[model samples]
Target: MKARVTVMLKNGVLDPQGEAVRHALGALGFDGVEGVRQGKVIELDLVQGTSQATVKEMCDKLLANAVIESYTIEMA
Candidate 1:
């Protein structure tokens, strides 16, 4: 089994890294971009039959900071 997790800052949170990327893009002449929000993707290899609930538990425990970040899980 495999799972992919995406973690991102919640709306209304400050994202300095994302802002920096937007600024850099403008400087590099890709001016159409108006905003950027940075996030992370984590791929996990798990034992067969691993459940999405288990993956969610992992996110709740460590993969994401519940107060400021949210995560989505995709299992394969």
Candidate 2:
């Protein structure tokens, strides 16, 4: 099985890197770009029958920083 994890900043969080990207894009004439919030997508290969609870544990333990970010895991 494979688990895909997406980690992102929560709403109302400040993202200076994202702001930089947005500003650069606008300078490049990509004016339609409004906002950009940087995030990460991670894929993990796991043994079959890996539980959602276990995945969440992994996120809590290592994959995500709960103080600044949130994560969602999808299994395939």
Highest lDDT, which number? 1
Candidate 2: Cα lDDT at 66: 97
Give lDDT for model 1: 0.97
What is candidate 1's lDDT per residue for 5-66, written digit by digit as tens? Answer: 99999999999999999999999999799899999999999999999999999999999999
Cα-based TM-score, every candidate: 0.98, 0.94
Q: Over the full model, what C-alpha lDDT does candidate 2 score relative to the true structure?
A: 0.94
Report residue 25 deviation for candidate 1 (angstroms): 0.3
* Separate clash counts for every candidate: 0, 0
Candidate 2's residue-wise lDDT over 1-76, tens digit each? Answer: 9999999998899999899999999999998997999999999999999998999999999999999999999988
